[model samples]
Target: MALKPATNPDVEAATIELTIDGRAITAKDGVSLYDVVSGTGKIVPAMCYHYTFDPFGSCGMCLVMVEGKKAPVRSCTAKATAGMVVRTEGDDLFQARKKAVEKHLSVHPLDCPVCDADGHCELQDMAFLHQVTNLANAKQKLIPEDTRSLVLDFNMNRCIACGECINICKDVLMIDALQFAKKGGFTQVVAKGDQPLACEFCGDCLAVCPVGAITNKYSKYRYKPWQLKKTTTTCNYCGDGCQMIVETKDREVVRVTSPLSWKNKWGDRSETAKG
Candidate 1:
């Protein structure tokens, strides 16, 4: 099922003045700095921070430096107060984000050529932004592939521990199948036991993963990023999501819409298409 959004519209009433990317703006008291920045159409790399869920700062990809604040704060968790200055991009901020991406890439399986998420992976974009060319893979490249009913190409090293999989499995989908297992270098979220993935097949985790760790087995080697285009429409397949379109070269559909079609689908939630 599609996760419901936090419908507290009054949450934005508590006003605070802020600046992002040299653009002045006003936002609510409790809204995360990430939301404020994103509201302005300024891109700050993020993975785990979802608008509908409580902020989990485990993914340090959205760190932004604040003026008068000694240390950079996690944009996903930090509330925007009155007169706060948030800088999304700069030399210093870039370096800090570079290190974060570097850490994520250190364990990432550097398989952009064959990985299923070659075109639209979030981590891949941020890595290029940070000027990260290649990573030192710690494991053998010949490991056997993981093929399940839906997910495939299981590369444990590609995961950056963004917790999107864990969050979707637990919070959004109400399934506790995926969990963190291990302490340091070998840390990962493997499926529990040898049992089937046991997921609702919502693909919410795949939607939020920063890397290409979890992918639909059926769609593997089927599509590329530049090969498809996202058109405005709703999804008719599920109870969640509005109609959306994927404009492909050969008139083929690539991706469907998610249920969170507030502005993207119907311009508001009240007009959500009945499934």
Candidate 2:
């Protein structure tokens, strides 16, 4: 069906065409690379790139090799340009992804066996996907639990310091308890609480967290990823309806992502891509 239509009609409406995985795609000039990727069926995963907050590329998870561009740039924030070639998964991407996984898993507690989000966690799915499709990664990368949330483990060892949790906590949720400190390998996520993290309990942080560093206590040991049956749909969380595909692995809501859009790159006019 046609995307519910662009809510507000007053929205520069720039235009451009770019190459994604080799196919020429046209889209609004200002639309983010994430919009283009999501518009297509390729389904590049993104944990922290939310439409509500300012686009922060700290997650480094959405990195896509841009043709003619030296380094892979973030699809979430980068503006799509004409004649641009976008490459998603590849050997170089695999290596980069593994390191990202290793970085997050390094400090993340080995709690999937006990964690509530085990079955539907995006991080777990990502790890499982890479391991199953590619050669498995180092088993010793697992880390121990650093902090506890009554039942959940808030391990810093698994954090990539994507700052997604922090940004969500600060900007979207306004709890501002979590923050990233230091630089380089020393960087770590911490709560400002004199007690525990002053979390608002939105759980968006848990949902957006790329690894198990942040977790849920209630769902621990309850479900498995493959056990859940996923269905593509929309987000009722708000009015824009934001066209999303919801995952229902175990007859419950799991996650959401962008839906097809005419304004989006892939959904753009077929004639435009060839232009």
- lDDT top scorer: 1
Ten contiguous residues with the weakest lDDT in model 2: 1-10
lDDT of each: 0.64, 0.58
State candidate 1's TM-score: 0.75
Backbone clash pairs for candidate 1 read 150-217, 233-243, 233-244, 234-242, 234-243, 234-244, 235-242, 235-243, 241-258, 241-259
Error of 2 at 111 (Å): 4.1
Give the range where candidate 1 is weakest over 10 consecutive residues by summed lDDT: 266-275
Give TM-scores for every candidate, taking all chains together and pairing residue i with residue i: 0.75, 0.62
Model 1 lDDT at residue 223 = 71
**Which stretches of model 1 miss by more than 4 angstroms?**
1-13, 19-24, 134-153, 183-185, 192-194, 228-275
**Candidate 2 per-residue C-alpha lDDT over 1-275 given as tens digits, one digit per residue, 9 for 90 to 100:** 22311211135456778889988776766656766666666666555555445567665667789888888777877876677889998988776765565555544555667555555555677677556333334334334454544533465655656676777567755678777765344566766642465444545566566555665555434555455555656556667544554546556765442332111222332222122
